[model samples]
Target: MKLSDKAYEKFKHHLMMGDLKPGQFISQRELATMTGVPLAPVREALLRLELEGVVQIAPQRGIQIVEVSLRFIRDTYQLRMMIEKEAAAKFAGNASEAMISQLREVHRSVIARVDEVGPSDNLLKDAQGIDDSLHDTIVSSLGNELVDWLYAMNNQRIQLIRLAHGHLTLITPGTFRQVMTEHMAIIEALESHDPDAAASAIEKHLTAALHRALGL
Candidate 1:
């Protein structure tokens, strides 16, 4: 990847991993040092993040991480539901065996690791990865570039909300397990080739996620 892209990924990782708290202010130089990138690339990364509303730049102060507000959460979840419901319905109508297998494997992997679960950063990251993969698979199946782009942007905001929430209370291992179970419900509904069932499952999951985001 390009240096600027590397800087952006690293900076985003730190932000999502709770290394940088929401509403915290830090210098560009500090971000450069933290991400092991040069000042120019860090500046480029920060500019991108600023445009995304993940952070803001000030004249005299430094970059300020954006705070997650309830409105943002509600709006984001609404967008998520709009896309995911349609995607799930489509997926149920035409999901290939390979697609079902992929989702099933993701769920199985997370469930198998339940014994090793911990409230550590790595565990959270791993869970996030599996969750993202499952959702991305469904979203990508729709073959809509615009929808995919919007979903990706909203997903980042959701991650920020999750990180902010983690600061208040640790997400237990049971929650991750429950998440995987919820994912399995969607997968099962899709595998049944019942559009109504799949859409309903997607709606329920997104609704629960909105509730969780509200808790943030």
Candidate 2:
């Protein structure tokens, strides 16, 4: 990998891990040293992170971690509801053995790491980039091309907005634990090959996530 990519990979992990707290200033020199990259490459990586809304840059003060916006919090949860509902309804009708296996695997992996602690464990967030992988896989398995294309494009914007908002992480390890039992409900629905039940589970899951984020 290129030095810039390497730096980004390293620093990105830190950003996701919350090791680099929001509103904290990050120096190019410090990042270069920490990630074992050169100054130029570290600078390049910082620019990329900045563009991704992961960090804010100042002329001489270097980069500062940014808090997520409330507007983004609303939009992201809204997007999740719109997209995941369609994904659930569509996938419910055509779910196959392979798809069920994959969904089960995601559940197991996430549950296993639920108590692992550290970076990998911090991924228990409700943010798009973090957990939407499972939801995206489910949606695509439905073989709906239009939903697939638009979801791919919009998911990034939603993820960016999600992480840009600080308090939004609460959407995950927050009270939403009660809400996440719906994933198990989804699994049961899929096991029975009941399209309506599966769609209901996913729809409720998305709806609850949205409402919780709204504090409603």
Candidate 3:
């Protein structure tokens, strides 16, 4: 990877890992040190981040990380719904039967583990992976690199918001079950080859996720 891309990835890592906080201001040199990249690469990374709305660069002031807001939450989720619902519809029509079956089995396995163990660390980690995998699969099925890129950027912001709000570690049994069940619903629709049902399920699932992200 290029130094600037490395710097960008490192910056995102720190942001998601809570080392770099939202609304915090840091000089470019500080960012360089934090990312272990030189100042020039860090500057290039900051410009990209600024364009993505991940950070703001001011004239005399340092770079400021974006703080979570209601608008941000709504906008991110809205974009997710727009992209993912279409992806779900498309995936329902084109996804192989083997892939659909595997998705169903994995979701079922996670749901069973949650029921039996009540959210152990390992189970939670598995659940998080399952959650990410399902969405990633649906989005990648769209086969549009630009859309994929935009979805990834939006997903980073969504993850950052979730991390900031304690959503990552505070998974309750009920919440986990609901999420898995929602995934199963989408999977079922996909298996049935009903594009409309798949799209509707995705929309419903994303709507619930939006409410949860807003702490509703």
TM-score of each: 0.80, 0.63, 0.95
Candidate numbers sorted by TM-score from highest down: 3, 1, 2
Residues 19-106, model 3: lDDT tens digits:
8887789999999999999999999999999989899897899999988888988898899999999999999999999999999999
The candidate, 1 or 3, that scores higher on TM-score is: 3
- lDDT of every model, 2 decimals: 0.81, 0.67, 0.88
For residue 59, what is the lDDT in candidate 2?
87
Model 3 segments beyond 4 Å from truth?
Answer: 168-171
What tens digits encode model 2's per-residue C-alpha lDDT throughout 1-216? 999999988986776665676568878888888799999999898788777666788888878876545675666667666777666666766778887877777765665565455224246552224355667677777577886766764554454444444354344555434644667688778778777787788878777666655556
Candidate 1 per-residue C-alpha lDDT over 92-181 given as tens digits, one digit per residue, 9 for 90 to 100: 998998879877886776666755554466766677777777778888889999998888888788777777775322335546666666
Index of the highest-lDDT prediction: 3
Q: Any residue pairs clashing in model 3, and if so which?
A: none
Error of 2 at 69 (Å): 3.0
RMSD of each: 3.4, 6.1, 1.5
Off by over 4 Å in 1: 105-129, 167-171, 174-178
Using TM-score as the measure, the top candidate is: 3
